[model samples]
Target: MTLFSLVATHADLDLETVGILSSGAADVAGSVDVPAVTLATCNRLEIYAEASSDDPAALEASREELIDAVAETSGVDRDTIASTFRTLVEDDAVSHLFQVGAGLDSAVIGEREIAGQVRKSLADAQNAGTVSGHLTRLFETATRTAKDVGARTALGSRGRSIVSVSLDIAGDMRGDGAAFYRDACVVLIGTGAYAGTSLAQLQERGVRDIAVFSGSGRAEQFVAERGAAARALKMEELSEAFSAADVIIGCSGGNRQITAQEIRTLAGIGPEGREKDLTVIDLALSHDFTPEVADLPGVELITLESVKMAAPAETEDSLEQAREVVDAAVQEYLTERQQRSADDAIVALRRHTQSVLDAEMEKVRKQHGCTAAAEEVEFAVRRIVRKLLHTPTVRARELAAEGRTEDYVQALQDIFGLEVEPRERPEREQPAKRRRAEEFTPAELAQMAAHLQKVPDGGFCPHHRPGEFAVERLEVAQRLTQAQAS
Candidate 1:
């Protein structure tokens, strides 16, 4: 069965739409007799939002329509198509693609944040039951590959982030006095990886007073680990914390956690009745703070997009280096996958060919009896058939490896008369039932070997006898030389 994959970045499309599109593509592929198709998205936000799509009926209808189309065209049941599609998504190819793109194998990178995003996306898909075999395999493999790449490489060993970029931006914002000891109060909203990193950098900048907020239980430990004069608050106390802060940095997993109205409320109050020029940095893909938050009086909302724009040329260069590493890893993975696919096909082909040969030999032996002459004839026939089939079998495999398998497969089917032909109902009626063939015993095998020894030279067989077989010949020659020395 052939397998194909489609990968795209999740920029603006809703999560459910992505899932529906993937399901549709998989269904279409199955209709065309394609065994598997996997749809993978790189953006975490797009994957996460699929579960809460406003149109459930529309989504279900789309899925059913696709499945029905495939079932009608391919003559495969909806259940089988569904199961196979599910299986295909869970395959290794999907995982490798994710690992290669997520900076896990990057040369100079420490972005474990992408890993978290991937995990969350997969989890969402899984929870929604949208993760069929294909997607499940893809995500699992992607996660494992990412983990392996991370462990084996130095990709996640560095510290390059928005916090570092912000430090540089802070340098630009604060001028010469930025690096000096400052008693600034920094309020970090959402205690995720990005927030924690920013907090550490802020501490290094000598911002002694820090307030960290998170919905997760880890927020308290995250605050204590920084060793800054810090306090951890629940997500519910965000508005209260915003009023007493000198600078505000927001990062959260929720879709649009902070709004423009909240920023306005923070701006309206402060010591001496003067509004604070709050710098709000949002690292979440869906955006923690609204774009309108920037319009609030003396408040700045910096998103991932904005940070990317404000980043220096050096940061861009580093990102390029990381991309190169990921590309190399992807190339390596694809090469390995191709080789594995070829190997699996070859092994299965060999087994099928051997089974056919064995059945034919057994039938000939049973008809002709186990006499020496009869056995010789049977052995000769078997040898001749094997010799005749060898080149074609090898050629078919070579064609398969070269991506030209169809002609070779058709040729084999034609030669063997194995192609299924349509028959009339009257012709098919009262067809003789085929009986189960008996297996050969050890004694029968030994007798057949002895009978083969009596076959004439180049008479349905090239070799002289059973002993003349290459393996037997080698053993006999070795024994004769040993006997002569003794």
Candidate 2:
């Protein structure tokens, strides 16, 4: 299977469109195709799909058809599609996408929430049987790379999110000189990550009356550790706690448990002369409190989405910087991918050569009527080929690592008289066919012009260019120039 990576964002299409595109790619492959496309932002989606074929030409054709099909189906411009994909497969962009998607690039950097999201997406693809061997490796590599980058870099040192910001805002809401711990009662409903964080923030803000309620004893130890009042209550005590609490932070995974009736009941129980003002913070995927609670005489409801907006601008900038880190990582990943691709090609070429050598030796053995010596000849041939190819293979890998894979690959093909189908070429062509003088450096342009002067139509020389060295020489020179310049 040939792997192709694409980058897109969530806003580009609805869930239905995503489904259709995934299903369509799968149909083309005659199997469930897993898209390793990750959502880096509201505007970005990265897709890595694989096409199967033993023949490189057929594979290339199939890939093109798939690209065209996706563009048509999504009603997006082809250039946009290509550009998005280039970012994914290209060295810089791929690394960034992986990092960002992994949540390592989050504003509250290294929050661990992004890792879960990435895992979930991968799980969804796996469950659907869309993840094949190629995609599996790609995703696993990306995940590993993200983990490594996160560990190696200081990007996650001070990552904070809207939750952290909310705590700051909450502290400000309680006026200065009024000790939070002495003045107001803070009730944290639910024992989720966000709730725990909010509770911690409240404590940090000097909130004296901190109460934590969970359906089980899970949070009791945590609350005790924080030296806060804790109670394990059944679902029924929600209204009583709501009535008694001044600030309520709700972060749960279940359905909307705080109903309108519950809010009304809480409001009704408050002192008639001086009504209670309840602040409800809902930080769950499915809201923990009903919107109708906002209409309560003295109740204020804050959804997760709203709180995210209220987060400090600096927090956003931090997240943006984290994203930049991710982008750098993606570029590194792309370079690795290029090297890997070159390695795969070399491996394939070696295998093919070995097969031919084995066949020829076997034929010679049969002709000599010496079956006993067949194994010896086979071993001898294998050693010879390995020795002969070792330097070139090693050089190819080195070039790939140095971002000079094209030269080594071209040289290998030329030397072996190997016909690399179009799909095997790593370079993508530009739409406008600009002249060499405009595109290449003066030296490169002169070299090309010189070489063309020797050919009938400014094409390659068949004899001299037939061997690997010819291609290698040009590529190495180009790479050296680039490296020196850099």
Against the reference, the lDDT scores of all candidates come to: 0.51, 0.57
What C-alpha lDDT does candidate 1 achieve relative to the native structure?
A: 0.51
Q: Which tens-of-lDDT digit does each residue in 1-486 have in candidate 1?
A: 222233333333443333333333323433432222323321221121111112455434444454555456445566754443321121343443564336432221344555554565566554544444434444565565556545555444454454566555544564553643275667777776677667777877777778887766667888677665688877666667777666777665554466776666654643333454566666554466767776666565555555445644435544455455555655555454444444444444555667777787678778876779777876787687678657755775576556555555455457654432212123233778743223545455455445435544323344454345433222333343445446
Question: In candidate 1, what residue range of length 10 has the lowest lDDT sum?
Answer: 45-54
**Clash count, one per candidate:** 19, 24
Residue-level lDDT for 367 in candidate 2: 85
Residue lDDT tens for model 2, 1-486: 445555444334442234334433323222323233333222234455654543567545544554665677556666655544433333334454476555643433455455544555566576665555545555666666556545655545544554665555555564552464456776777786567667766656666666677755566776666666455544566556666677777776454377867667754544331265666677654466778877766666776555545644435655566566566666666676667767776776787788899789879887876666777777888899989888877787788788787676667678776644323333333676644434567677556545544443223473454343332234444444455546
The C-alpha TM-scores of every prediction are 0.53, 0.57
Task: Give the poorly placed runs of model 1, Cα more than 4 Å off.
Answer: 1-112, 115-159, 176-182, 191-207, 215-218, 221-230, 234-240, 255-261, 264-276, 314-328, 361-486
lDDT (C-alpha) at residue 132 in model 1: 43
> Against the true structure, whose TM-score is highest?
2
